[model samples]
Target: MNKCIFFFLSLYLLCFQSFAQTSSVKTVPNADLVYEKTKLGEQVNSPYYEGQPVVSADGKFLFVYRVGHPDNVGYKTYKKDEDIWVGERMADGSFSTMRNVGAPLNTATNNAVLGISGDGNTLFLYDQYNLSADYAVTNIAVSERTTDGWGKPQSIKIKGFRWVSEPAYMNMSVDKRILLISYANNRVTFGKQDLYVSFLEADGTFSEPLNLGKDINTAGIEASPFLAADNVTLYFSTDGRAGYGNLDVFVTKRLDDTWQKWSEPLNLGAKVNTPFWDCEFSMTAKGDVAYFTSGGQNYGENADVYQVKIKEVARPEPVAMIYGKVLNKNTNEPIATKISYTNIKTHQNAGLASSNPKDGTYKIYLPKDKAYSFFAEKDGFFAIKENIDLTGLKTYTEIERNIYLVPIETGVAIELSHLYFMQSQPTLLPSSEDELEQLFDILQKYPTMQIEIAGHTDGVGNKQKNQMLSVQRANAVKDYLVKKGITAERIKTVGYGGSRPIASNEKEETRKLNRRVEFKVLSK
Candidate 1:
C-alpha cells in the first residue's frame, strides 16, 4: 500500500510540473477540437467564392475579395470576378451585407484586399495599380484614406521586386514595423510559395524579400502569413507541413529578433483545417476571435470568409489598442494628421498611424510591458503630447485618448500633458523633462512669445498644502525655462489649487485630471 501511494504521488508531481511548463508557452488547438466553424451569415456570402479576408484592428470592419459575382466591378465570368469588397461586423459576431468598396480600389484588372493597417486608414491591395498584360499578381499597392474617399492605389516599392503566385497574400503588423508576405515563382525560394518578411526601412520602403528559411518553407508551398497584434506569434497556411489535406493552417511563435528563428510550427488542428485549401488567417486586437478563408474540397466552391472563437492557449500575447481622434482645440473639428508613438524610455519612435483625413480618427497598437509616448502634429498648431505606461498590462485593453491641438497664439492655454513628479513635492520627474525641453524649443522658435505656467492639484490633500504645492510646481517649470535661456521676466506663474478643477474631485479617477500643469500664451 505504501509503495503504491508513493508511486502515485510521484506521478502526480511530474504531471503537475509538465502542465505548468506547457501552460506558459502558447499551445495550438488539437485535431480533436470540434471547431465551431464560423459563418458570415447570408448577408455576405453567395454561391460564388470569397477569400483573402483582412479584419481591421478594431474588428469592426472586414475587407475581402470575391470571384464570379455579377456585382463585381469587372465581373465577366466566375473566373474574372476579381474585385474587392467591404463589410461591417454585425452585433451577433457575423457580418452585415457586403458591398463593392468601389472605384479606385476596383478596376478593370483583377485584385484582392491583402491587408489593412492597424489604423484602418490604409489598405494593402493585390497587384500594382498598373497590372501586367496577363493580370498576374506581381506586387503590392497601397491606398490611403482621403477627405473625399480612398485615393488611388499606389504600388509600394519593394526593392528587387517581381511577380508572385496567385492568391499572393500578405499582412502588416499592428505597429506597421514589419510586413509579412508569401510568394513563389521568383528569385529566392526554399520551395513553391515560400513565406518571406520585409522590414520597414527608414525611408518608408520595404527591403527585399528575406526567406523565412527551411524550417518554415518546404518544397510543397506556404502562403497567407498573418502576424498577430503581439508581433511575435504568427499564423499561416502551407502544404509543406504535415496536416490533414492539400493546404492547412499552422501557428508558430517567433524565437528572436532575427525573423528567421521560430518555434516549431503546429497544425491548428482538424477543426480550423480542412482537407481543402485554407488560408488568410487574421484576428482582432483581442485575438479571442479569428477570421480566415477556406475552400471546400470542390474547386472554389463553398469558398467563403470564416470566423471562429480562438482557444485561449492558441491566442497571442495581450496588447493595448490605443485609439481616438485629433481635433482642433478651438473649433472642436477633426483634423487630418499623423500620429506617432514612441518608447518613452529610449525616446525613439516605435511606429506611426495616419488619422483619417476626413474624420481625424486614429488607432494604434502598443505591446505590453513598456512605457509609451504619443502625439499628433499639425503645421499651424501646437502638438498635444501624452505618455502612457503599459508595463502592468497583462491582458488586452482598449484605451481611448483624444488630442486637442491648440493653435499657437495669444490667449491659448494647453496643459503640459505629461508632467510627472514625486508625491507631495515640486521636483519634476526625469520622465517629465523631455516635455519641458519641448516647451523650450517652442520658445526658441517664437522668440517674442510670453507665457504663463499654471499649476493645479487634486482636492484630496490639505487645502493649504495643495495651494503651496501648486505654486511651487509652477515656479519649478518657470525655473527650467529661465535656465534654458528664456528671460525670467517673459514668463509668469500661477497656482490654482483644488479650487478650480476641470473635473469633479469626488472620485479618484476624475481627481487625477485636476492635477496638471498648463501653459497659456500671454503674448505671441
Candidate 2:
C-alpha cells in the first residue's frame, strides 16, 4: 500500500510540472530591449468589447470590430452581432470619436472588417451569411471607395466551392494579388479553423482556396491571420500549440517563393503575449509599431486595442516609411492631392497614396534596395517632385517631409527633377518617363495654358557645344509630349545653355542643379 501511494504521488507531480512549463510565458531572447506598451484609451476604446484592429497605410485611420454598442448599426442585441467602426487619428496623435462604418455593410447581422488595401481604397469584410440568408454560409466581401463614399459590397465566391463557413479573418498582399484567409468548415481544413490562401487569377476570379498545411495549422483553432507589407512575414493566433493562454499570437516567415514551406513558428514572448487572450496583431507600414487586442486590468472585462513600440528582435523585414502633410506654400492650408511613387531601378511602381482632403496628410511604404521618384500633384498647383534613395540601406527608417505645392502663375517656373539623359547625348533615359508623364498631365488639365520647355547645362564643356546640346534636349521633350497627343503648338522650346544659373556651379551637387530641364508658363 505504501509503494502504491508513493508512485501515484510521483505521477501527479510530473504532470503538474509539464503543465506549468507549457502554460508559462517564455522570456524574450534579448535582455536589453526598449519598448513601451500603452492602452489606446477611451476615445478609441469603449466599455464594450473591441478587437480585430487594422491600421491604414497612412496611419491616419483605424478600423476595428466593436461589439455590444447600442449605437452600432448592426446591433441586434448586446454581443450577438459585431459591427465595424472607424476612428480617425487627430493631428495631436490621439483618436477622434469612433463612428459606425454603416449602410450595406452593417445590416442587423455580424459584419467585421478584416483588412484594408495599401492605398486605403478597398475594404475587406466578412459577412456571417450570404444575402439569401442561407444557414452555415459565409462570404468575404469587398467595398471600393468611390468619389462620393463606399460603394455597395460585393461578395467574392470561389469557383466550385459552396458554403464557405465562418470566414473569421482575411488579409491581402501589398499588390492585392494574394489573399490570406482564416475560415472554418472547408474540405481541406486541418482543424476546427485553419488558414488558407487564394490568388487573384488573370480572369478576374479568385482561384480555389489552398490550406496552409501542418506547419502553420493544427487540429486546433487558428484565426486572425495578418500578412505584413513585406509579404514574407505572417502573424496569426492559435491555440493548438503550447502557449501561455487559450490563444496566443505566433509569427512565421515564408521560406521561399513556393509559400508552402515556412520557418517554425515562434511565440511573440511575454512582452507582447500574456496569460489572457492576446491576438489580432498588426503593424504599421514600417513595422516599428504594433496594435493588438489584449484583455487586462486596463480593459475592464473585455478586449481593447493596445499599442506597443516594436522591438528590433521582433520586427518584420526592413522598410522605409514616408509620412507627412501636403500643404499650400502660400497660405499653409492643407491641400488634397494624389501622391505617386515609383522605383527608379526596377521601373516598377512602389505604391500610391492620397492626401486626406480634410487634413492633407499622407503616408506610404517603400522597400529597401531601390531608388524612388515621388511626385505630388493637384489642380491649380505646380506638382512637387522629389527623389528618395534607399539603395544599400540595412535598417528601417522613417522620413517626415511636409510637401508644399506652389500655385501655378505665369511667372512661376518648375524644374523637372526626374528627367534624365545619357552622359553627353540628348536621348531621354527610360527613368525620365514618370516625370514626363506628369508634365503631360498638367498640360491636359489646363488645355488653354502654354509653356516653354527650357534646358540648361553647367559650365563644364565648350560653350557652343553645350548650347547646341541644350537645344536638342529641349526639343526632345517637346517632341515626346507632342507624340503623346498633346498639341505641338502649345509647347515652345528654348536653350538657356549656361546663361541662367539657379545655383553656384563650383561643386558637383550644385552643377547637377544647374544642368536641368524646366517649364515656365507663357500664357493661361
Please give, for residues 211-258, the per-residue lDDT of candidate 2 as tens digits: 888889999988878888777889888877777665777889888767
Winning candidate number (TM-score): 1
TM-score each candidate: 0.77, 0.73
Give me the candidate number with maximum lDDT.
1
Angstrom error of the Cα, residue 221, model 2: value is 4.4
Q: Write the per-residue lDDT of candidate 1 for residues 53-76, one digit (tens) a residue.
A: 788888889877777688887775
lDDT for each of the candidates? 0.80, 0.76
lDDT of 2 at 91: 91
RMSD of 2: 5.9
TM-score of 2: 0.73
User: Which 10 consecutive positions of candidate 2 have the poorest summed lDDT?
Assistant: 25-34
